[model samples]
Target: MSNFEFQLAYTVKPHKPERDETDAALTRQHLREKLGLDTVEHIETTLLGSITLNNSTLADRKREAEKLVHDYIHDALKELRVLSTVKFYGCLMVDGLGPAIRFDILPK
Candidate 1:
């Protein structure tokens, strides 16, 4: 079996309302500089998981990787109850024997 590493980043809806989009960054900075809370958006969440496939070919791996990512997106949409964009980054073999593949999948 071939082991794959996956990092999924997603931004969910119903994010805290700030004065504007810029305020999100300003708020984080203010908290970090003044209140010492280094937190960005309390809305976004990341899902990290790995998949072990029975195949070894790179072509097969790529197909499986994309399918896995789409599956995550579907789950997020259904369970999180929000539109989210999932980016698939740093897909690599667990044994560190080949080049890694990275890509992004935007929301529909």
Candidate 2:
């Protein structure tokens, strides 16, 4: 088994009655800067977690990350279900959850 660090991101749908346009705009700005995207229209929030799994391939890790993201979206934040676009990013064998790991993940 190996340690996998995962980050889950999702954008709330604009049509939701509870959605705040201002909050969404701020979220979009924050995520665009964080993810280094040129432009992003939807509000995005990122959640981080770690899991140990038997798989070694990146494909397996990707599947596990997506599954984890889906489970979290379904269970913890049920409101996001069918109303949000989700993504997962994963890296193997992170040294620590501190600066070392974060520096490695940051875009160069």
lDDT tens digits, residue span 1-108, model 2: 777565544453333335544444543444445433233235345445566656667656555555544554344323423224322232322323322121111111
Model 2 residue runs over 4 Å out of place are: 18-44, 79-108
CA displacement after TM-score superposition, residue 81 of candidate 1 (Å): 2.7
Q: How many pairs of residues in model 2 come into backbone collision?
A: 0
> What is the lDDT, from 0 to 100, of the residue 78 in candidate 2?
31
Clashing pairs in 2: none
How large an RMSD does model 1 have?
9.3
* Candidate 1 lDDT over residue span 1-73, tens digit each: 7676554443322233442334334432332344322233453333345667666776776667766666654
Badly placed stretches (over 4 Å) of model 1 are 9-47, 84-108
Candidate 1 residue 100 Cα shift, in angstroms, is 6.1
State TM-scores per candidate: 0.42, 0.41
